[model samples]
Target: MSGRQGAAISRDGTFDAFDLCARRATLEGIVDATTLPRMADGVADEGGLARVAWRIEGTSDALGRPALEIGLDGIVPLECQRCLAPFEGPVAQRTLLLLARDERELARLDGEAEHEVVLASVPLDALELVEDELLLTLPFAPRCERPECVGAATAAGAAEERTSAFGALAGLKPAPKNE
Candidate 1:
């Protein structure tokens, strides 16, 4: 593991995938959540600061294909869809990406469906890859699963106790048949 910690990787920095794999190099760093614009859009508030730690290593997959293993862990503030409240959610993900040498090879590997296949575009944007993985890990509809949140939702629902809009229509009866 390389000691390239504390925002060592710039947003535009690129890495040669082939060389990294050959050397089996590992890079790890920390990035501010605010720096990731796309990820900020998914969170509840952009004002709060969050730190995301990431690690990437170049190696070979079980099938002997060049690959990159990525790991990310962080906490992000998210809005609860159930109670409409803000809460902190944990994010952790690990993925193995197989690299294909060319477009033709990418298409062929994509059909396997057993592993994630990506084009080994020389000088790959490492920061962009980290951001992409973070976005993918976010919940589509974030909901606070805590017991307090659940209780609050139940209490609010009971307090409102709204009658159904079609309740009056249910009371109507069919008209008697004309003689």
Candidate 2:
């Protein structure tokens, strides 16, 4: 699905406290080209849509700006790296966000390279963050348990060709030998 959108930020500059109780969040109107976080091992691929939910908690900083913590639980459909089959699984992660009131603070926090820093002048979309984190959590290389996972055997049934990309050139004729 394409054109999906994340949960909307509220006008109050804070997520509705009641939303945390709903137990579900629907992200809609997002575009297909959007990318998610991926596992460093190169096993996980976030090439498609994701559905998510989160439990949120928050408090105020010294200036009364909202600071939020989110615990995510969700599911995503992905293709197996080995079998090339599609499957669905759970995605879980934790994120903390800081809401900034002034443009200067937002710019300052956004410029920081620290991993934990997330700056927003208004209420941030927790669902988007959760989706992205799930992408990051994916395995670098997902594989199927079956011996046929790589399609080593029964090569004909495999979805992909077994030969190397250069195989075609190998068959080309060499110059003729002396008569």
Model 1: lDDT to the true structure = 0.78
Clashes of each: 0, 15
Please give the lDDT score at residue 105 for candidate 1: 90
Lowest-scoring 10 consecutive residues by lDDT in candidate 2?
A: 25-34
lDDT of 2 by residue, 73-159 (tens): 665565676567765655666655555556787677667634344555434565455555555666555554566665553575442
Please identify model 1 stretches exceeding 4 Å from their true place: 1-11, 152-179
Top-lDDT structure, candidate number: 1
The Cα error of candidate 1 at residue 92, in Å, is: 1.7
TM-score of 2: 0.44
lDDT of every predicted structure (CA atoms): 0.78, 0.50
Per-residue alpha-carbon lDDT of model 1 for 27-90, expressed as tens digits? 7777876678787667777437667898878889998889989888888788888877888888
Colliding pairs, model 1: none
